[model samples]
Target: MADGGVDEDEKPVGELFGRLIDESKAYAKAELGLAKVTAEAKAQAAKKPALLGIAAFLFLQAAVVVLCITLALALATLIGPLAGGLIATIVALGIAAGLGLMAKKALESGQ
Candidate 1:
């Protein structure tokens, strides 16, 4: 805007630096906010109950398997070996089939 150049005394360095500092502060604040949001999002995802529920469910299934094996072994010892083995196999297959059917139905129903 100056025809050629202005005198050095007329230049306003203070105003220029003031504006730059304000813009820098705003940018820094915006970056800090973004980082905070990202950290919170990660923490919330980790804290979700779905993960706990899944771990609990897996523990329950493991307990059930151990119990079933113990019972089957006891039954086999009390009864004849052949009959006990056959009975345990049948029961295991039946449970597996039932679980498969339940899972299929749940999937079909979309929850």
Candidate 2:
């Protein structure tokens, strides 16, 4: 201590600012680490739903294939096998085209 009991290492301005800058740097680093951990946790939480979405997409594709086969077989009981397959393909293509047109119209209207 100095004669007035002030700490000898204390400077009026320079020491205070230096400590402030150091603390600011440390706080910034800690905040960045916290943000990284938070992002990782959020990503982990979303992983299961992401995987389930992919599984659902795969299952839907399999179901569509099975349904198409069943449709063709049912038609074949009435029409011949060749005509049934052709009719099924044409119907599927027409339905897909109709769906595409509807989607385009909906998007345009939304905009």
Candidate 3:
């Protein structure tokens, strides 16, 4: 050993290590930014199909409503409005009562 065992030649190696650390951090930041952008794009892409599904469901509901109206109108044509209204109300009530009775029976049997 010479000059009291002091070393100054490792300074360049330390600087190079520091630079590598900084560069690695910058690369990781860039990759994270890219991932965020990709996720946003995928989310946006998914929204269109979701909206379309909602629109389709709404349209189907509207079609069912229209079909009911058409049936009511046809019944009105075959019978007078007063009689058609009475018959439709009776039919709906009968269906409801039947369903209720069936549910009661099923519940009683289960118990």
Top of the candidates by lDDT: 2
TM-score of 3: 0.43
Give the best candidate by TM-score: 2
lDDT of 3 by residue, 1-111 (tens): 337574555446877799889999999999999999999999999999999999999999798657556666668889977776666667667777998999999999995
Cα lDDT listed for each candidate? 0.85, 0.90, 0.81
Supply candidate 2's per-residue lDDT for 97: 100
Which lDDT tens digits does candidate 2 get at residues 19-80? 89999999999999999999999999999999999999999989987887888888999997
Q: Please give the lDDT score at residue 16 for candidate 1.
A: 72
Full ranking by TM-score = 2, 1, 3
Count clashing residue pairs per candidate.
0, 0, 0
Please give, for residues 75-111, the per-residue lDDT of candidate 1 as tens digits.
Answer: 8898967777677778878999999999999999998
Q: After superposition, how far is residue 97 of candidate 1 from its true place, in Å?
A: 1.1
Candidate 2 vs candidate 3: the TM-score winner is 2
